[model samples]
Structure formats: C-alpha cells, structure tokens
Target: MKFGARNQITATVGTVKTGDVMSQIDLQVDHPHGMSSVMTTESLQELGIKPGDKVRVIVKAIHVLVAKE
Candidate 1:
C-alpha cells in the first residue's frame, strides 16, 4: 500500500505485547537499532499483523504543528 509518497520498509513482527485494553497492541520490530514500534488495532489489521507475521514499517519525519498547551 502506497502511503502518500514515502516508501515503507519490510520487517517481521518479532514480539508483541497485548495489554488489557483490546485496542492496545505494542509491537517489537526487528530493526537495525533494536528499535520497537507502536501500532493500533486498525493499523495492525491493515498490515495483516500477528505474532511472527511480516509487515512493513514506514518511517516518516514530521514537523511539530503546535506546542503542548
């Protein structure tokens, strides 16, 4: 799936932490920096994500629109 104009990186779902809330799904990705990522129910489903499932991780740089009020 093309998100805007940026490319998405293909990665595998290494680990997952499912919280008490059904909507809370924390995922640990096998990144070069040992970095992890956060994903929501909608996003997870969109990627067809599951434990041991493969998914694409898109990294985007965004500017802050507004300061914390």
Candidate 2:
C-alpha cells in the first residue's frame, strides 16, 4: 500500500495484544529499538497482522517536540 507518510520503517511483528475494541501491536524494528502502534481490533484484523509478520510502520505528524535537560 502507498501512504503519504515519509517516515516508514520496515519491522517484524513482535507481539500482539488484542482487547475487546482495540489492539496494541509491538514491532521489532532494526537494532536496539522498536515501536508500538495502537489501533482498533477491526483495523488490526483487516491488516492480518500476526507474530513474525513483516509490516511497515508509517508515521505522519505535523509537529515533533523535543526536550533536553
């Protein structure tokens, strides 16, 4: 699928936790870090996401905030 988001990362499914209405998907990304996405259970089902599956993580945002101590 094509998306407008510029930040897309290829990752492998690590874990999937599905609730009654929502699901939390954890991706095992490249080296040292990973990401998580929360979506509706229906959406998750539509994507057919499962453990060990390869998927793209798309991130689109207008503003990103950074904090320094």
Candidate 3:
C-alpha cells in the first residue's frame, strides 16, 4: 500500500472501543507517548480489528490512521 504519510509505526492493538457510529482504537507503540485512532464502526468491522492484532499506524498532520494488513 502506498501512503503519503511518512511517519509510520508498527504497533500492537491494545483496545477497541466501539460506539453506535464510531470506534476508537488504542495501540501499544514503541514511542514514549500513547497513540490511538478513531473511525466509523463500519470501517472497524471491515478491518476486523481486535486486541493483540498488529497494525500499521499512519500519522499525518491532523489524523492518525490504523491499517491492518
């Protein structure tokens, strides 16, 4: 996959919190600070994200995206 965001991190999924419309994903990264991302619940389902999964964390100026491959 081609991502314009240069800042990427390899992280493990720590938690997934799903609301009615959106879901929040917490990740365990190697960096000092914590990292998390939010997306629609539908997207979460499509990705099949769960705790302990390894994901690619994409960091842009205004958003943090989680990609499961």
* Candidate closest to the true structure, highest lDDT: 2
How far off is model 1, as Cα RMSD?
5.5
Give the whole-model CA lDDT for all candidates, comma-separated.
Answer: 0.56, 0.90, 0.89
Better of 2 and 3 by lDDT: 2
Question: What's every prediction's RMSD, in angstroms?
Answer: 5.5, 1.6, 7.6
Identify the candidate with maximal TM-score: 2
Question: Across residues 1-69, which tens digit of lDDT does each residue of candidate 3 receive?
Answer: 878886888899988999999999999998787788999999999999999999998877456456898
Which portions of model 1 show Cα errors greater than 4 Å? 5-7, 22-31, 41-48, 63-69
* TM value for model 2: 0.85
Give the Å error, residue 14, model 1: 0.6
Q: Of the pair 2 and 3, which is ahead by TM-score? A: 2
Worst 10 residues of 1 by lDDT: 18-27
2-69 in candidate 1: lDDT tens per residue?
78525356666665665443343333554545445765656656666667666666665462244686
Instruction: Enumerate residue pairs that collide in model 3.
Output: none
Clashing pairs in 1: none
Q: Candidates ranked by TM-score, best first? A: 2, 3, 1
Candidate 3: stretches off by over 4 Å: 62-69
